[model samples]
Target chain A: MFNNPVTSLAHVKTGRLRALAVTTAKRASSLPDVPTAAESGLAGFDVGFWLGALAPAGTPRPIIDRLNAEMVKAVQMSEVLERLGALGVEPIGSTPESFARTIDAEATRWAKVIKDAGVKAD
Target chain B: MTSLRRMRCANDRLGGARVALVAAALFAANVAAQQAYPSRAIKIVVPFAAGGPSDVMARTLAQRLNVAFGQPVVVENRTGAAGAIGAEYAAKSAPDGYTLLLAQVGDTISMSLVPNLPYNFQKDFAPISLVGQTAFILVTHPSVPANNLRELIALAKSKPGALTFGSSGAGAASHLAGELLKGMAGVDILHVPYKGRRLPPLIC
Candidate 1:
């Protein structure tokens, strides 16, 4: 039942499927009326699908910075914003350091969740 | 005869000098190419099928980057292993700036879920800017009769193991969302995992 808004939003609009809640900290802009899981009684439920760009390890820092600058600028462009918004995605242009920290934090959090839930890749 | 020998030596020295100059020129050109930081086409590898959210996002960025850098920025779909196949490929590629991976939450989670993965997500890749993020929507068939999250939790509670939720894959973000919901809500909904991001026709 966990589906992306790209494929599921149309269904929710047409009433083919009922969206119970979005699994994120805030309400999805595309579906402003639908409550987030936390708002709907699951106090701390927050999950989201994020996309980040990555280069192989040892890529030069200057190159990384250049790519980062272009990415930050790209995400802010009105055309890119419109394209991403149609998919129910919120653009986030972050520093490489912050992105690295996010990866580390998410890895740590999901590691615990997978271990506790006994989840395995098939 | 002595002049002939001297002439041969002079020719040899000139040839050697010419070769050294060419070698130095080529080396400098290579360095300049490297310093240019994308002298050729840049590839963005998406570890998913074409037309999915990840691919879409990658393609969108690729188009913009192609214009911004004045070089071809293409999106390559290297689908398999719930994103590990493409991830491993990107990780092992030359550490040049041309190759990049469109990474997602599942890539990070795979660090723990899949054993013997060839590459480490944290160790093998350098983070760039985060493009965007989308939330997963918990939806159900109209027949299930759950109006909202609370109602759905209650229904799952009453029915116990009867309710089923489907995800894109076993360790995908969708599956983890389901697990989180189950753990936090303390319900026992059966998890049905499909092969790709697309759910079974009946569920959607």
Candidate 2:
């Protein structure tokens, strides 16, 4: 089913997303569609990734684990998360092994997409 | 009289040679200045539109990096096709550390998003330490009176396929974030695509 506002807001006068829609419309009327400011609350969404930091495919496990431990410690700090959030950044702290798997997976995924799309280096 | 004229002519030729020597010395000094690493200025490429988050971050960071390096670090925006235009330009730049790319998540994701990109992220460039990362949050337009994420989801669920979320574009992170919210919240919000940046601005 589709519950999107551009489609649904016309129907519900009392919906929360609808309420936001109203406020956002009012805000836009006062502001330019694209503001010169680099960071503004007008755009209230965070969308990006912080994948695992990878080394050579065969790098030793000990070093990888140590790096992961350091990253985990850094990301776990409440202050760090808050700062990242303020900048619209999400913090993802995951295991080295897991991160490694994700990196490999993403690499393969993109490679296939490129191949399928007939994308090549220019 | 002939001898005096010859002497004068020789003197003039020697003076001309001295002037040539000084010119050569000045040219050498200028070459020396150019050869000096970061002797004058540095440039950073922000492969995104100006006034966007990444561009702002790059400028801010460039200021700090400039202070650290004792040189002027300038930010140049080369926005197009997500970030391909900037990345391609950065790759073609001098490998000298003076010219660097202030790449972020979008640049990396472009590898997956932009098929058959001309440059390889891993091959053409080096990863300087990551500056920082921005996180995505699920915010509804303030029009919806449901406070917090739960109520928003509940309200959307009550009206399945009746809600919509604006995202930057198809295949963008915001698009995925909306999709992820749909999957996790089990609420279907139609995806409204915007031409530039994130979708939230266009929706409002």
Q: Residue B38 in candidate 2 has what lDDT?
A: 54
Model 2 chain B is weakest, by summed lDDT over 10 consecutive residues, at B195-204
User: Candidate 2: where are CA atoms >4 Å away?
Assistant: A1-122, B1-40, B141-145, B154-159, B196-204
Candidate 2 residue lDDT tens string, B1-204: 999999999999999999999999987865564455456676778777786656665565555546555778788898877778877887777654456665654555577766688887666654433434433334455555564455666777788877776655666654555564465456766776664422254222
Q: What DockQ does each candidate score versus the true complex, computed on alpha carbons?
A: 0.65, 0.09
Instruction: Please give the clash total of every predicted structure, in order.
Output: 0, 35
> How many angstroms is the interface RMSD of candidate 1?
1.9
Which runs in model 1 stand beyond 4 Å of their true positions? B1-35, B196-204
Q: In candidate 2, what are the lDDT values of residues A3-39, reduced to their tens digit?
A: 2222333333443432322121122221223221113
TM per candidate, chain B = 0.75, 0.67
Candidate 2 reaches a DockQ of 0.09
Residue pairs in clash, model 1:
none
